[model samples]
Target: MEDGMGFWNLRNFNLAMLAKQGWRMIQGNDSLLYKCFKGRYFPRSSFLDAKESLGCSYVWRSLLAALPILRSGYCWRVGNGSSISVLGDKWIPNHPTNKVLHPINELADEMAVSELIDSKLHVWRSGTIMSLFHKEDADAITKIPLSRRVVPDSIS
Candidate 1:
């Protein structure tokens, strides 16, 4: 692929493609919905509108909204108070903001991408870490792995 494509791009493109077919992601910032990912978990900052990005699981929340299922239905976001909620026919937090991560989330820090790379663990969740690419419009970039059946000629 080109030089850059992250999980976010993979997910956004996946969702957008699905939306075009009529399926959609869910609309709430429900912690339950987030629990679906293998290493996914709620970050402590979910309780606050924090500036720190790039690593927090909030990206997962954003990705969920970018999912084919949710994106076709409703957009997910934070609402009044400290609630993680959705805006639709009616506005509401899917659940109480007091929702905390399961104890497993604590143990998960070690499994983060940074920790894996630092530990010299060559295997990421599955693939090898090759490059980091950040782009303004992911769809405009055709080098993305998810975009092709075979790994891009450049990387392979």
Candidate 2:
């Protein structure tokens, strides 16, 4: 029992040290575990997309197990809205669902919220809003406060 407690304490201390340095201590470009955790949500084309790759280290497998929990807590914060997909991103607030209902017109897959804003006026383009969003959705979108200066979108 005493040996187990000592091991547990040492493990926690190591984790705390890693946390303190923002996990920068574990830096190795070739490390499978590092690759898995660093871009778990958006993996590079060369990296393995599978949750459990064959012959993966125990650490890599453990990171895969934690991916779902990490993803569940992530939420989008609309800023300039350039990065978010108009129909695909979950930027809308206070709706039954965060995504916009079926867009009236078939917008490009990469269409962004910023495209709906009038560049000169720095406000939502009424015509575009009316065309893209349902009445209720348009009304809900209008309530979101737009900053005078454009900023980059963020994930929280």
Candidate 3:
């Protein structure tokens, strides 16, 4: 394997001599080594695209354009540009069942996750009980006058 200086000089020479003159050169073995160092996500497919995109002429232009975006850390995010539905913690399926019957909280180590799980279960039970008595639910209870409210220790 070439040292960093060796790779740097190679890229320097390739970019300066070939690319600057509108000629393209995609060094296959070198690029494999380069990507291995860089943690490229889609290596094989990206390699194929790079091969075609950087074919024997004018391909360096795209690299020039791509450099800034790469430097700025502007890669696509997971939920980006898609019509996927967003769901929150309240949509947890077992919430209603767990609320009706308290479960072992020791299954979770983190206080936030465990406490939130317990709270959801309690909320579910409260709503169920309220419904049985034809009474307004906790969401309705939330809108009651602040002066008459009793807040939890965590909230205060």
Candidate 4:
């Protein structure tokens, strides 16, 4: 390769296609495939949380294998932040990890993004964010603009 980069080869291409399928399944919940997977594997949880189970279908296993790839590339567009976790979910847009990377200060990992959002105003609580995260993280958090219109958090 001119740049010393390796080719995508068959394995990489297969994984990429699988990851794309997983992405589609996440984004298009109305699809029958998504509905089937949800009912069988992740009935009470999100697709990202689904784990391998005994006697699972080959397709489900393949999709599960590609989840890590999907996660590394996906970012959640914060809405009300009700469904997103402050420390766990990937909500920060430009940050490398796409998550709150600073040490937690009196904040639980499972805390909802809504906790940092002013629901009435649909804006991030800057003071609260600053109080909780380090300067760099706080700045990153503030840079993620909020939409005044109400919408559910979606993958980007």
Best by TM-score: 4
How many residue pairs clash (N, CA or C atoms closer than 3 angstroms) in each of the candidate models, in the order given? 8, 0, 1, 0
Which tens-of-lDDT digit does each residue in 1-156 have in candidate 4? 123475547667778899999989889999999999999999998888789999999989988989999878888998889889888888899887898777676888789988989999888899998889999999998988889898999989
Task: Summing lDDT over every window of 10 consecutive residues in candidate 3, give the lowest-scoring window.
Answer: 80-89
Q: What overall lDDT goes with each candidate model?
A: 0.29, 0.61, 0.29, 0.88
| Model 1: CA > 4 A from native | 1-13, 17-33, 36-52, 56-72, 75-156
Ordered from best to worst TM-score, the candidate numbers read 4, 2, 1, 3
lDDT of 3 at 145: 25
Worst 10 residues of 4 by lDDT: 1-10
**What's the TM-score of each model vs. the native?**
0.19, 0.59, 0.16, 0.90
Q: What pairs collide in candidate 1? A: 4-133, 24-68, 24-69, 24-70, 25-68, 25-69, 25-70, 26-70
Q: Please, what are the lDDT tens digits per residue for candidate 3 over residues 1-156? A: 357665556555554453322211122334543455224322453322343232333443444434432323222111111211112111112233212132233333221222221242222234333433223223332222222222221100
Model 1, span 1-156: residue lDDT tens: 123653356655765664432222122234444334322343443211223345656545455344334332342222111122211111112322212212222233223222212223222212222222123111111122231122211100
Candidate 2 local Cα displacement, residue 44, angstroms: 5.1
Q: Model 1 TM-score?
A: 0.19
Ranking by lDDT: 4, 2, 3, 1
> Who is ahead in lDDT, 1 or 4?
4
